[model samples]
Target chain A: MMKDEFLKKLRSHLVKIPEKEKQEILSDYVEHFQHGFHKGRTEEEMVRTLGDPRKIARELIADYHLERAQENQSFVSLFRATFTFLGLGFFNLVFMLGPLIIVLSVIFSMYVTSLILLITPLFAIEALLMESSLLEFLLRLLTSLIGAGVGLLLGMGTVRFSRTFFGWFIRYLKSNLNIIKGVNKHA
Target chain B: MNVQFKKGVLTLCVLVLTLKKDRYGYELVDHISEKFLIAEGTIYPILRRLTKDGYFTTYLSESKEGPPRKYYQLTEAGKLYAEELIGEWETFNKGVDQLIKEGLDHDEG
Candidate 1:
């Protein structure tokens, strides 16, 4: 392939990237071609040496999404990065989805449990009001209030754990990506 | 001969190359390709990544040949990173050498 053809293919594959960044990426290849020409090489020769444009674009896109996920730390970018890896191959589906499903379920259950515990006082309100004995009413209210306090603490703990888990999940994804990239094969 | 293995080392090579002097994308590719084969175009993504990571700062310089060139200079953090990688590489290299020697001797025996 000549330089123009190669760059054209690369540009098409890079539709996901923003215009400015995409242009910058293409310019790098254009500069590469110029360098090759200066070294007395043909465009076809340069293309052959550069390997496949598709693979190059894949790496660029993956890197871009990964960076975005890391920076924004939003669910949208994280899911986008995860799906991008999933698109890379079938193996990623198992690796990416397994932990994702497991962690999310665990977090969901924790939140549910905490919410139930927090609402215990509401559930006990009628029982406390109907009790004619003051001591029994006080006992019920005390137990209910304790449950609510524990619920609050558990909710706070879950939030902290989720934040830490978020950081950890990102790191895990990064290291997983490095392994797939084969950059960490020796390390 | 593994592509991934070469890629992992390519980052180290790029770091070490720019340790002494700033180098352009093509120049870096040329120097490394002379030692081992690589898809020349792949180096650009690596360059882009390292630059984005802030390990290297780049500037455009006018070349005598065609158009201006983008030259990569190692940042202070890049130097520290390169040194750390070099250390890990040396230890890893030693372990691999030992394993190879032992395997060869066992085969001969």
Candidate 2:
């Protein structure tokens, strides 16, 4: 019966406040009621001191508006932070990827150049030593293939990390949206 | 008085008063009660109905003593509505006055 009265009063209070603010006021009062009960105040005494339900509802409605205004100001700040974090993360990925691509390209080019340099010398040495030029050329080509495979692995690793970071950020945004919807439904 | 009739007129009165300025629920009750012998409980349901209808909006202001009071104010639509009601009331009063005067004159004759 008391719970019903409390909910009735609470709904009356909510009518004066905006939907978003109403939940906040309800939670605050619920907490206060719990704390007061713990302090050994009898339910009847507590309700009496709280005064008429209609009157208390009026007061809570006023406080709800004030609190809502404060929350809106903070919401603007949080919005800025969210955008800033996303921007910084995006730029950080760009910075890391740019250097990674450039380094990989440079290393691959150097490996190709070194292979060309080594092959010419190797063929010349094979010719001078009367070894088979074709055998020597084939041996140097296999070593160059191994070097290119290692470079490809390193490049793939950099791309993998970049993708992972973006995926995590998208997941975070989706979860945050879900949380907002849940709160709205509850309100 | 019939509950429906009282409710309709009281709602109209509240809308008219709130058009001038915001008034606390209790103050509204007291103001109307001074003129009509209506129960305090009656005003609350009317106020809620008016609020739901968009004729009135409510807010709370802090009181020096005790809890804050809920104040009701008329919206723009409510003001327009009140003006039309006021015009109709004036016409009805004038007609009633004329009828009463004629009746008194006939009685004298």
Candidate 3:
């Protein structure tokens, strides 16, 4: 491929960085191609030697955003990190995305379960007002209290679990960053 | 070399190579790629990271044949970092070697 076409392909694949930095990176490649040409190499040889522009961009983008996400722990940085990881390869699609969705669902369901449990006592009181027997009312109250107690415990567990999950995910993504950078063969 | 092992070693290699003399992007790429079956672009990200971390500083110099080229020079921090990393690798390498020797001695017995 020609220099312009290669640079265009690379730019298309790169996620946004600041414009000046983007220029700096592209200029480095431009220098590479320029030097190769001066050394009597063909554009095809230069491009081939450089390897896949998309894959290179993917590695840089994923590693950069993931590092930022780790340092900042901001939602925006994490969203960028996850999105860039999805662009990486089939491995990330299956391993990263699958677990991310599963963990989110688990967290969500735990929250719903806790809310339902905590509200049960209120509903039981309403049921007693509708002419239920004293024994039935007492039973409902007792069961509702037990349900709420379990719910509170589960709710607290969910909080702790979420923190642990977030930490593990950060470490997992950090290692995955190594794979993207060709530091690790597999993550 | 294993890719994981090479990644760490490559950083050290780059530092050692540039300790006294600055090297350009293609120069560094060619030097390392000659020994390892690496994609030439792999070293660029490492260079960028090291530069970002203040281990290396970059400058552009014009050549007679073409456009300017960017060169990487190790900084004071980079030199210190190289020393620390090299020291750690030596300790780790000796420990691994000793363990391997012990295992071989047992196998002979």
Cα TM-score per model: 0.80, 0.37, 0.61
Q: In model 1, what are the clashing residue pairs, if there are any?
A: A50-B41
lDDT by residue (B45-107, candidate 2, tens digit) is 456545654678778677675445677888887788677656655555576689899999999
Question: Which scores higher on TM-score, 2 or 3?
Answer: 3
Better of 1 and 3 by lDDT: 1
Candidate 1 residue lDDT tens string, A8-107: 9999998579999999999999888887888789888889999888888887887788788777766566666677656655244456677777877787
Task: Report chain A TM-scores, every model.
Answer: 0.68, 0.30, 0.57
Candidate 3, pairs of clashing residues: none
- All DockQ scores: 0.46, 0.01, 0.26
Residue range A11-41, candidate 3, lDDT tens digits: 8877676677678778878878877787788
TM accuracy, model 3: 0.61
- Share of real contacts kept by model 1? 0.45
Cα lDDT computed for each candidate against the true fold: 0.79, 0.53, 0.76
> Best TM-score goes to which candidate?
1
Least well predicted 10-residue stretch by lDDT in candidate 1 chain A: A176-185
Candidate 2 ranges beyond 4 A from true positions: A1-187
